[model samples]
Target: MSHDPSGHPAHLGRPGHSGHPGRPARIADVAALAGVSIGTASKALNDTGQLRTETRARVKAAAEQLGFVGDARARALSSGRSYTVGMVTTDSFGRFTMPVLLGAEDALSAGEVMVLVADTRDDHVREAHYLRSLVSRGVDGIIVTGRSADARPPIEVPVPVPVVYALTPSTSDADVSVTLDDAAGAAAAATHVLGLGRRRVAVVTGPVTARSAELRAAGARSVLGDRMTGEPLFGDWSERWGRRAVDQLDRTHGRVDAVVCGNDQIARGVCDRLRETGRSVPADVAVTGYDDWDVVALASRPPLTTVDMRLDELGRIAGRSLLELVAGGRPASTAVTPTLVVRESTAGA
Candidate 1:
């Protein structure tokens, strides 16, 4: 370490820094404060290899006192790399995106990589702008996420960075994605109902326009076959819809033995409606739901038998996939299957 004009210790902290009052701290300020050349400060900040461990530590400490943020733009220009990942999502509320983004961030953090996330609210223009900005910033990769089991358009940026779509797939086969096995989840629900020896079955679920609802309905249909009664009783993703659907099934199908619900809220409603009509769950009727939302499932009259999407694991896999791509591995698509969490709702007494 070198001394200043007064021969005072240069790496102490604020005392070593000199600047116009309230002026923003700069790299030069960090170097002066750390008793190092600008080149050493840059190396320490960027984590460049072959740096002296003690010198780097001293420089970092000075930078903290100065509140200096390394110039990412300058580093990117000089090294042609930015050890950062950008995660884009429409779900700012994080619902589906949280677990996936956290998984990716945690995995990347262990490798000294950082993640920058943006919420586009599914806006086309905003999505384009964020992609362009992240590309220009030289992010190593990106992860795109949407609300449900569906497909969206690919990121239109021309940059070389890899983008992994999570929850929602990309319509482009060239782009990689990680999603749940929707069909398998529905099949499991239907099978559980059938396994309880309930031959007469019906479907109760959300809107017809939702791809998730359609796929789940198809999965249940494939399992129920001749045993499935009536068309899928489509309604909103709510308890009211579930209760109304039960009434509709009772009117048309007369004596249904079981029902597969699209979500726990609907399943809970169905159970309430069945009891109102003097039907005992699992004895007179067995009901199963998807997306084992514990708060709703566990609070049901009889604890619900539901499918666990394992979203955190899906997020982890998605993170792993993006890291693999960043490390020069071939981009490959993957599908994660959900699990069945059995409870009293489908348990035959």
Candidate 2:
């Protein structure tokens, strides 16, 4: 017996069996069990047309009993379509793409489609590799998600399939695109603060290069007009940035009556800092955040008021768009609007 490097019994290279006992239970076994011809079995297993219900049932039952899964590779080779869809994301998956991905996956699952996810870590070379890999894998469609609008996607590879871009700005090369209406969301946030009778509102946001951020700022400006005070404090979407930004706001501008955070994480940080400084939420200074992630909003001392980006909806729409494109439908783009979730962070009156 051969031992693996870890001293475990090696499962490979064994005598008589070549370490593996059975050929991955082929269609032949299914056919034999079903008492059907190989061609009939193949058709039944692939769900091709024109088979009687009873015949299809027997073939399916036999294949299931034998643990026979049709070869995806063979199907792709014969049909010229790979049933897989590829989702390519930038390196910062945890911060931004998590909700978007979840939404996309949920939508795809409902459509009986499988998604193959790849991470580029924001590297152009890696992005290119993954794009090529998806094409080589024979994926029927693709979804490219960028961290921000400023992301210059890597060179496009010609593939015999449709590609959808999500959460990124429109690309000349894409068939469909979907993103949040950041300006509307930001305006909503500003309106929430103004409704609370706040005249001076500060903003803590991520890099200005992010299109979503820029749009949000613009929206806030539209509502607040010249009453919006202080320069936007820029930082990454982290609690640390939130804390520091709040500290800076306090030092520079004194007690601002309202704050609109770039995201939930930053909002939480700002809220924490406000509590530490003995400021009463909504009473002393109202706070609002974007990306109304429930856990973060509800867990705060006073539940946070936030803008719901409707990430799941974004995903479903994108998935539907991609599926439509894959089915030879026309190219399309969708802009999902965000809604405000009112909580203790903002005053109702």
Q: Which candidate is the best by lDDT?
A: 1
After superposition, the stretches of candidate 1 with alpha carbons farther than 4 Å from their true spots are: 1-7, 10-79
Per-candidate clashes, comma-separated: 0, 2
lDDT for every model? 0.84, 0.78
Off by over 4 Å in 2: 1-21, 46-54, 173-175, 226-255, 276-278, 293-301, 347-349
1-349: candidate 2 lDDT, tens digit per residue: 3345332223322333222357665777667667788999888988897899999999887766656766878877897877778988884666467777888888888877788999888778887788888888888888878667553543487655677777774556445678788989989999888877899899888777777777788888888886688877778878788788888997897769899988887888888888898887878888888887777878876788999988778877888888888888885687889999898888552
- Position 125, candidate 2: lDDT: 84
Please provide TM-scores, in order, for all candidate models, with all chains considered together: 0.80, 0.80
Clashing pairs in 1: none
